[model samples]
Structures are given as structure tokens and as C-alpha cells.
Target: MVAVAAALALGTNAGAQLYSTPAEVTANPLVKGFTVSGLTLSQGQTRVTLDLAGGRLVGLLVQGQGAQEVARGLVLAWGGEEKNVADLARSLGAEEVKAQARTAQGFAEDSEGTVLRLKVTGSGNAERWSAYTSLLIHPDSAFPTTANAEGNSKAPNVLRVFSDFQCPYCKRMWDTAHRTWAAQPNVYRVVHYHFPLEQHENAEPAAIASECAAAQGKFWPYADQLFSRVEDWVPQPNPTAKFVEYARALKLNVGTFQKCLTSAAPRTAVRAQYAAGLKVDVRGTPSVYLNGVQMQDYSDAEEAALIRTVTAASPSAAQVIEARLKALR
Candidate 1:
């Protein structure tokens, strides 16, 4: 976390409230299988997991001690669910920790906060469910973007993105998906989260700046400026002053913004958002969740394809949007 404040900011959702609780999610006739997230599991650590059919969720679970292993696990899990841990790790064409080859329990939740405890009791030919370690339960509210995550509020389709300010790929997603679908306020909503990558030296500070900008209702504008000029502040040893300049340029209250910077609040908020991203298995920056089904790719092509697929498969309006979001959430 940055000592002062995060450097970059995100947006305000201009879209509709759409589905939050489970009742709002109806079955998606076109989609087969489902991913039930917020299923709390422990590996000496607690993590929110997506429950897939056939005990496949166990395969996607990551093992080991380091953050790098966790990240690698997420990348592999993004490939798709596997029958067991072995398949999950090796099938992705990268070898990591092998599954513990043991029985385990997990849990899932519904809209009303009902908890469903599950277990991977058997193994190999007799395997009932493929699991690595412990299982637990959590609330449905654990998912979904924060209220500050901004975009079109009236739109039925809520697109949540976890992004890094310095990531070029993230910028591409903003240009292609955000600006495009966001243009249609009635149909699409956007919620943004910051996931500054570790390698991006200036990413955290940039996030802090954007967060401060948001405090004064200049989030989107400040974000735009930061994105447009990543090179200017990225290489600086300390972009703190440059970030304040962005505030000044945007006519934000420099005094309050500066004060906000000196406090740890903005940085804490930004890191909280980043932690939220990890809980949902965000493997990479610019991870786009349109209506909560992560887009396979962040390009305009995937965006169009996802929109078309979701639109066609969904019943009248974007009701399926809620279903998908609920499933992923």
C-alpha cells in the first residue's frame, strides 16, 4: 500500500441496480453448468471459490505458500475447471503444486444467504468430489462491485472490471469495452475496481491519486487523465506531486485532495478493492465481468460476442445478466 494515497482512481457507475440477491437470478437456458462463488474454503487461509459441477471446483483450487503460487493458480483456474487438482495444474500446460489427493469439504450460498456445505469425500475411481482442503460458508453479499464502482446505473447489464492504471491492456479494455457498452446507458452499466499489479512500480500511487480524485467527484476525469498520460508519471520516482497536478488541472479542491492524500484512507480503500478482486479470482488486470460472467478476452471482439451471446440467450431484457452475475458472484 502507498503511504500517502493511491495514485489512480476509478469511475462512478451510471447504470441500474440490476440483480443483487439470488431471487433476481433466473436460470440461463443457454448456459450450461454454473459457477457458485463465495464458497469459503481454507488452506490455512480463507478464499472465496467458484463452485462448478462434478467437484471440478477442487481442481481450480491453488496450493502452496507464496503469492506467486496463488497468482499462478488463478491463471490456471481461469483456463477452466478440471476434474481434479492434477488435471487443473498440468492440463493448463504449466506444472505447479499437485493436488493433495485427499477428501475435503466446501460450501456454497444462495441469494437469501442459505449455506450449502459440500465435500470432496472420495478419490481416484471412487472420488465423490475433487477437493484439496477445508470448506466453509459465506454470504451472497460477498460478491458484486462496491457502491463506488461506477458506470451507467440505469442499464440492466452491469460490467465490472478489475484494472491497473499502468497496465496498457487495462487501458485497452476501457477504450474498447467500457466506452462502447457504457455509451448505451439503457443496456449496459459499468463498475470499476483497481487491481494495481505488483510489478507496476507506480500503479499503487496512481490508484491513490484516482481515489483522491473520486473523493471530490472527479474520479472519472482524473482516471482519464492518468490513463492518457501513463508515461508522464509512471517513470517518476515519486509521482505524488504530479498526481496533485492532475487534481489542479481538473479543478478539484487541491487543499482537500492534498489532505486526503496525506491520510491513509484512500490507499486503504484502493487496497481493499484490490483484495476484493483477489477474493473473486481476478488473475490479471482488465479482467472484465459483463453481468458477472468474465469475458474470455478484453478486446472489443469478446465484448461484442459476450453482449450478443448474453442478449440472445437471456430472456426478455437482460434478466440473464442477473443470473450470470449471481452465478459468478
Candidate 2:
């Protein structure tokens, strides 16, 4: 992918562009040549690299030193309510350049997890400004993985999916995509995270109920039931009793399941997972990631091919970054 490099973090939140699939970086016509790098976590000093049109090169996510050191491109996180950038010195790296640029236009997004973008059209000293390159960085996402999953735990391919119980698309993926994928022998393991949206009234309860099912080692089937029969419980103001009935139907210890569902444990677990989703910048339900990289949203045929090729024999994110860094040397 051609890297969409920004020279500096510019402008107020005019109209923050929220990036879902990395494909948007190139597909976008408004911002010329903006793109995301594939490598999620870069090992050594050199993590990410960007090549601009004018032979201007920069690192994206560099870490480490010496024998295996690599250079990463420079990037910054803009616009958050907290307005706090943790680990700025360590994560931003040694080579980060600070400069102000003229922002012609800009983007604004949600206060919690937002992707801010700014457009720069230089008119004055063009030669001096062309040298600096900047890339927007995603908040450090150490994905919170749960015991709920399918397939081999050690498989090379890993699909981390975030979903809400009341989400129809999540049901679509569960019935069509993940149900098929998870059944495959060695393809990939699916790790699920609960992301209960505020808009959905029963979503939080359903998430907690699913966690309760997880306690009894019935998360998958219980989840299937939730999606399969969303109409039954979601309409109700409080689905706690209905959730217990599902536990009974699944032949789980109905007593323990009831206790867990009502207790603080399941609620705490649900909130933690939701916060984790926010950390990874998950804005919508059914957010899926393959091998730590965002799978492109494309046509059914193209997406099928992408799913096959990327998961075929691709290295882990760390391994991929290391191999590329060494190649650069």
C-alpha cells in the first residue's frame, strides 16, 4: 500500500475522518496518497517506513537497537478528550520531528477513540516543507484476548473479532463467516471480545450473559443462541431471567449461571472488554482483525481471495516486521 504521509499534525477537528479499513487510505480522493502500513507491531528500532513522492522517507513504528535494529516512520495521535498521550517518548521514538503545518481542511471524530486527519497544501516555502513526513498513529492496542475462541490456539492465523449481541451484522458474520471459518482445521483461531454498544439497550446485559455462559464453558453455543434468537430477549427491558433460561436450555449449572449473571464479576468483565475495544479504536460492531492487521473491506470475491491469501502462510505481525526490517538493512 502507498503510505499516506502527513508532514505535521495540523488544524482543529474540522471533520475528523474515521478510518475503518486500511483500504480507505488509497480509495480516498480527498486526501491524495494517504495509506496505512501493514505491520502492526514493529520489532527492533525500525518498525514502520513511509516513502513519499519526493524521495522523502520516514519510519512509522520503530523500536529496539544494535544487531536487529530497524527504523520506523514518525507518527502522532491527535484529538482525544483525555488529551493525554501515554508513552510519548518511548512509543514516538527518537527520530520524531515536531513541526507546524498549514491545515487547509481537517476531520473530527468521537471523543473516546477517534482518528483525526488534516490536509496540508503548501504554497510558501515548498522545498523546506517537503522533507518532513508524518503519519497518524493508532492508540497502542495490546488487544485483550479472552478464553472464548475456536480452532488451534497456536495457529499462525488469528482472527480477533469484536461484536455486540444486539448487532445484526455480528449475527450475519457468526452465521455465515465465523461459523464456517472456526470449523476449519488449521486456518485460524477466533478470539472474541464483548463490545456492548450504548445504543443497544440490552447489549450490555447480553454481553454479560455471554460471559456467564463462558463461565460454564458454553460461550459459543450461548452466543449462537443470543444471535439466533435476539428477538426474544433483546426487546425486554431486562433479560436477566431469560438469560438464565438459556443457561438452563444449554444444561449448564443454572444456579451458578444465575449467580454469575447477577453478580459483579460478569459486569466487570464486560466493561473491561468494552474498554479494550475502545483502546484498539473499535468504533462499530463485528470489527475483525486477521493476524493483527485490518482485513480490507472489498467485494465478496475479492475479500474471499484476500482471506485465503493473507491467512495462507503469513508470518505473525512481529515476524513480518522483523523480516522486513532485516531486508531494509
Candidate 3:
């Protein structure tokens, strides 16, 4: 049996009041195949722990103000694989909860403070087995500010990209998006957010490095270097040295960049961006939002066409004035 400690801290106001306990699992139809084993309400947070027949443990921590959930953390474990879950929870700034018996674990958070439904499935033999944990975070969370954006912020067409440095799909999407954006640089603003998946051990560090480079006005270049050389550093025992090498190559102030890596701010910012992505129901890397609306499964041709449509629909200064005059008529 593996012992795992999951911690989640929701920084509510000092005088925030605790809300009522969450409804029982039976009360929420969205939850299936799990039994609620424990529930607690304290310090403006509600915790629900669930147990499955195969000794799987699932814990949920929620912080709310009045009747609204403002933040939440979901943790799932089976045999002894709580390390990933624990690390993810800590990255998102959640408090710790203890558990035993583990197979594999997953952690997810919500910045919007809304209810989430997840599907948990598992099967095992006498030696070892695995399970699939699905998390559904509500889609009402506010989008985080883009710390690394290319093009004009006030542009009418905006593209928000949620991605992980270690995700191959994200890299593919980046390649496609880069080509498209290069062709129409003034048509849209592209904002990048970090959503590092737990399976990639080096992803978090890469995200931190990108954010650190952003502080020095080189986020795009640093990200390009990291993605271009992902295969080189991902397998290294520690990728920080490689990250430093990239910083030097970018002509960044190495001292300031290295200090940023050790500081909590960059990691914290990455986590916050991840939480925001979850709030908007981002389940995978390369999730894109056009003008605040999620766009799903589009081919590169379709994406380019959509971009052209947005660009065509955008009004020029003279067109804006003409439209205003017509509206006044």
C-alpha cells in the first residue's frame, strides 16, 4: 500500500464564511459508480471523500463564498500512485489530505468554484493494474490574464491557447498556428496559457522557464526554443540546466532568469493559468478559444478559414464610424 498526502489551499478572504456541505453523491446524478465515504465542511471549504469497491479513493476540496463555489480541487487514487496527484494539488496551491492504497492518481482544480462530475473506472489482477480517471470542471471560470501574448491586445479577433510544453499534440498545433499567425499577424491576438499534464515530469519546469523568460520580454522566443528542443531535455534527470542554457542562448539575463526559476511566483502563475483553463472545460492541450468561444477539432484549413472570416468581419476605423452613424440614424 502506498501512502499519499494531497494538499490544497484556497486563499479566501480572512473573514470568509463557510458554506453548507455539498449534496450527497446520490443527490448528484452526474456522479456514478462511487460511494461517498466521508464529507466535511470547514474554513470556507467543503471536502468529500469517496470510496470504490476496488479500494480506490477520491477526494474533493471546495472553497466557496456564500452560495457560490469559488475554487475546488479533485484528487483520485487507486494503489500507490499518489505522487502525481499530490504534486499537482500542491502546484495549484491546495491544502493536504491523507490517503492510503493507490494504483494511479490524478488531480484537477477549478477557479470558478462550480460542481464537477467525473467518471472513475478500474480493474486489477493479483500483481498490478491501472484505471482511468475522468474529471469535469465547470465552464464558468474567468479566463486568466495572458502574460505572454503576441500581436495587438485590442485586436477584435483573439485566440487563447491552452497548452503543455511536453504535449506532442500541443507542439503540432503550435506548428500549425505559428504558420497561420505568421501569414496574418495583424488580424488576431494570440494568448498562451500553460496546462502541464501530470504524466510529463519535465512539463512544469518548462512552463516555469517560459514564464521566467516572459518576465524578460522573451516568452515567445523561449517557448519556441523549448518546444523545438523538447526531445533533448525531457529525458534528462533535471531539465533546469537545459532551461538555463536556452535562457543564455536567448541573451536573457541568466541571474534574473535562474532566480525566477527558484521563486514560487512563476509556478504559481502557471498553476493559476491551468486552473483558469479547467474552469473553461479544457481537458487537453492545444485547446483553443476564439473570441472567448471554445473551438473544437478543426483542421488546419478550417482554422485558417475561420481566421479569415474574423479578419474580414473586423471593422476598420472608418467602417466603425460609418456603423456608428448608421446606428444613430
Candidate 4:
């Protein structure tokens, strides 16, 4: 088995601090009557140890930390058939059994339980079959902030966005919020993270370029230009030149921007952000989170409503807008 250790740093809607450590389990200790079987020599298994309560898996237990329970939810993995998996979830108190698309992941929920399931198919008939399940006690806890994020760092309300520069939907969301909520730094803080889909060839390069621009304190504007003019450089043979052009237009030091682009720093930073997205179970581009709660429909209006809800007791909208406008200058 490939053994690797990493730390997962997380912050909540209430600004509570949390972190994750590598966890593993060789036995089915938490779930009673659950048996471990269907093992193949080649296809090994890795299970994250978790704590259960009231017929539902509640929190995870890391080595150094005492029972790091999830206030929102938990991700669980099970190896079995569809009916067996559903039955097990039901036994654990999951109510609705909504079967999603055959190839897509599925989810079922109850009053205080939500479970995300992904059916795993092994190589040929010689491999073992399994299903990975995420049992969310609090669904909102699944969304976390990126490490090197931008925007109002100290703002209580965090708008964590996982985006690809070349995604049309992402661009639409960005355009919708650019002038309103994103501009209002006092109402909500926007945190940017990279989720470059493999289909978008230029997306990763653009993400790296934006990180390089961030090194010069111009990530927001550079990202704006990237999304606004995606078609311009996306089809180019060497988009690095176009990135440089954008940097020059932004009045950034051309030499530094160019150097940062080719260097390992920007690439490493983008990779880390991508890893962070994966760790939080991001399925696609433009995955948005308002204060650690995943946004179902990513629209400017929806984002505004969430922000208002979080900061309801704070300053009025007009006052917040005025402060945001002043901060811009």
C-alpha cells in the first residue's frame, strides 16, 4: 500500500478552527455487524477510522488529535453491493434512498444524516468492488477554505470558490458577483482556489499565471482579465506569451511575472490548491461555499442572500456597501 501523511487545515462558518490528520482502520470497529470481506491481493483497501453515534457515523479520530468530530458531516467508505450498501445506510438511520445516475455519485438524507455514495468498479473481474460513502452529520462542514486564498482575510463571512478560468459557468458566476458582492469586501470575503479540469488545456497555465500575478498583489484583476478574455489565449499554442501580455497590461514587472510563471513556486501553489479542493470532495468547477456551507445554486443572488443571512445582525447593507467602496480606494 502507498502510505503518505498529510495535514488538512479547516475553518468553520462560526470561525472555529479544525485540522485533519491521516487516519486508517484495519477492522470494522465502529459499525456493529459490519464485516470486512471481498479482498483481492492487488486491490488493497484504506479506510479512515470514524466514531459512530445514534446509528450514524459522527466524527473522525486522528492520531494526535482527540476525536475530531465533524460539526457538519463525515465521509465513509464501504465495500459491498448496491442493495447491501443502501441497507447498511438505512440500518444506520439514512431514510431516503435516492439512486443517482449510474456513473455519477448518489446521495441520501434524513433529518440529521446525509450520505454521499460512489460505487467503485475494480479492474476486470479479478478486482474487488466497493462503494465510498460520505456520512455528513452537518453537510456544510464539507466545504473548507483554500490555503493561499485572496480577498478580505479577516472578514467573518468567507466566500470560498473553486473555479477554472476556462469554464463558461464559472465565468458567468464570476461576472454575476464581480460588480456586487465581490466588490463589497465588508459584507463577504472572497477566497479563490484552483480546480482546473483536465479538459481545459489552458486552465492550469492560467491558474499558475494568476498565482504569479498574486505574487505581485494583482490576483483579483489578473483573474478578472483571464475569465473576461478566456477565448483569447485558450487556443494559443504558447499561452505563456499571452499571460505575459496580460501581466504587462496590469503594470506588473514583466521579468518577475515571467520568472514566476516558469518557476516551480507558482506550479506548486496551484497544485496545492487543487489538492485542497480534492480533499474537500469538490466534484466540479465553480463549487462555491459561503461560510463553510456549500452553495447548491451558484448565483450572485444566492450568494448575496447567504451573506446577508450570515451577517444579519451586523451593519446594514447600505452601510456595508459604503465601507466596501471606501476600502476599494
Per-residue accuracy of model 4 over 168-275 as CA lDDT, tens digit each: 988988888645666677767777889899899999999999989999989888998998898999999789999999999999999989889889988887887788
- What is the Å distance of residue 2 in model 4 from its true position? 26
| Residues 169-221 of candidate 3: C-alpha lDDT, one tens digit per residue | 98887778655764565777888899999898999999999999999999999
TM-score of 4: 0.53
The alpha-carbon root-mean-square deviation between model 3 and the true structure, to one decimal in Å, is 18.1
TM-score: which is higher, 1 or 4? 1
TM-score of each candidate structure, all chains considered together: 0.56, 0.59, 0.51, 0.53
RMSD, every candidate, angstroms = 13.3, 11.8, 18.1, 16.5
- The sequence of per-residue lDDT tens digits that candidate 2 reaches over residues 1-329 is 00112212223221122211334322333223323345233322223232221121111222333111211112222211112222222322222221122332212122222222212233443311111122222322667747788898777667778899999888888888886777874867788899988999999999998998998899999998899899999899788888888888999999888788779988998899889878766788888766554443312445434434433433422333344334433
Comparing 3 and 4 by TM-score, which wins? Answer: 4
Q: How close is candidate 1 to the true structure, as a TM-score?
A: 0.56
User: Which runs in model 3 stand beyond 4 Å of their true positions?
Assistant: 1-141, 298-329
TM-score of 2: 0.59
Q: Which candidate is the best by TM-score?
A: 2
Better candidate number, 2 or 3, judged by lDDT = 3
What C-alpha lDDT, on a 0 to 100 scale, does residue 206 get in candidate 2? 93
By summed lDDT, which 10 consecutive residues of candidate 1 come out lowest?
1-10
